[model samples]
Target: MQRYFETELLDVKNFELPKEIYKHAIVVMRAKVGDHFELVTADQKVHLMEVTAITKTAATAKEIEVFEQLTELPVETTIVCGLSKGDKAEFIVQKGTELGADHFVFFKGEYSVAKWDDKKQKKKLARLEKIALAAAEQSHRTTIPTVAYLSSLQELTLAADEKGLIAYEEAAKEGEKGALVTLLKEIKVAPKETKRPKLQAIFGPEGGLAFQEVTALEERGYIRAGLGPRIMRAETAPLYLLSSLSFALELR
Candidate 1:
């Protein structure tokens, strides 16, 4: 079943679909009365809704079943990526959402090649938001991840706070490992009963983080962690980190 999001899905017993959703379901998808689809409301409830009526400008659906499912990371992990060139940020956001990232943040790294001015930043953010929404629906996620941009490493660290990690290539070469596993172990216990741990991991752009940036992160209480023995690209690192999180937190 297709999934749609509405802020007021549970406002009434049955609600008229939004204009964009109505057009997609009626005109593009050719959905008719009696068809069933999923609607995620403001409170993050997923309901199997059956179409009750359709008009030129509106479509109405009522709940048939409420799904008691949680398709999110056990820990509230946020990926803070250093700004990279081209569509790298888009790729990261799309795949990262599917892989269960709670939030995505991009910052201006010292070695970053791409710069986002005010106008372009807004446009890029809008595009990334759309990609995240589509990916969330396709992956059957209950919530769409938030996307944000920051100015510097200092701002990023402040936003993430003490519960953060930095993916450094030197750590990989140094044969340092298990930092993430240890962190996950400390947070993944009895997830249903315990408060969700908020974690943020930072990654560098094309040239990777400067030594001073890594040191600064360490000084700010971010533990330096390695993905594995292999080095990953600007886009690949976040996907790898998210997948690892799934393995440690969800699959295990």
Candidate 2:
């Protein structure tokens, strides 16, 4: 069934769809009166609704009952990376949303080649947000991840929680174990009575993070870790990290 995220509450009673949604539901999807579909509200609850009336600017639906049981990731994961060139960042946001990232932060790094002015930054963030919303709908995620732009490393570090890891390729070469592995091990060993862990993983741009930046992150209690032996592209690293997380938490 087609799924849509709507802010309005749905009940067995009649309801009207917004103009844009009416076009898609009635004209695009060719749904008619009595057609059924799934709707997820802002509160992350999925409900079944049946179309009652269709109009030029609106469509009405009667909510039947809740559909699937709501299931979410046990741990919240936030991926912060240095802004990279081209459309890679957009791709990262899309795939990251499907893999259960709670939030994304793109920061200006010491070695970052891409620069965005205030106006350009707003546009870029907006585009990334659209990608995230579409991805969330496609993946049936209850919540859409947020994308943010950070001006400096200080701002980026301030967003992290107590459990954070920085994905530095150099760390992998220094005989340190893989970051994904290390984080999983830590989670497994955590006491059941402990609060749910929140993880923020940072990645670098094309040229990677500056040594000074890595040192600064270390000072803030972020462990330096690596993905693997081979150096992955800036765009590909986040996807790799997100997949690892999904396998550890969701697939297991």
Highest-lDDT candidate? 1
Report the error of model 1 at residue 155, Å: 0.8
TM-score (C-alpha) between model 1 and the true structure: 0.94
lDDT of 1 by residue, 41-93 (tens): 76788888888999888889888888667898877889999999989999999
Off by over 4 Å in 1: 10-12, 158-162, 190-194
lDDT agreement with native, every candidate: 0.86, 0.82
TM-score of each: 0.94, 0.91
Residue-by-residue lDDT tens digits, candidate 2, 137-215 = 7888887889998888876553333488889988878867766686787876777544457888899988899999988
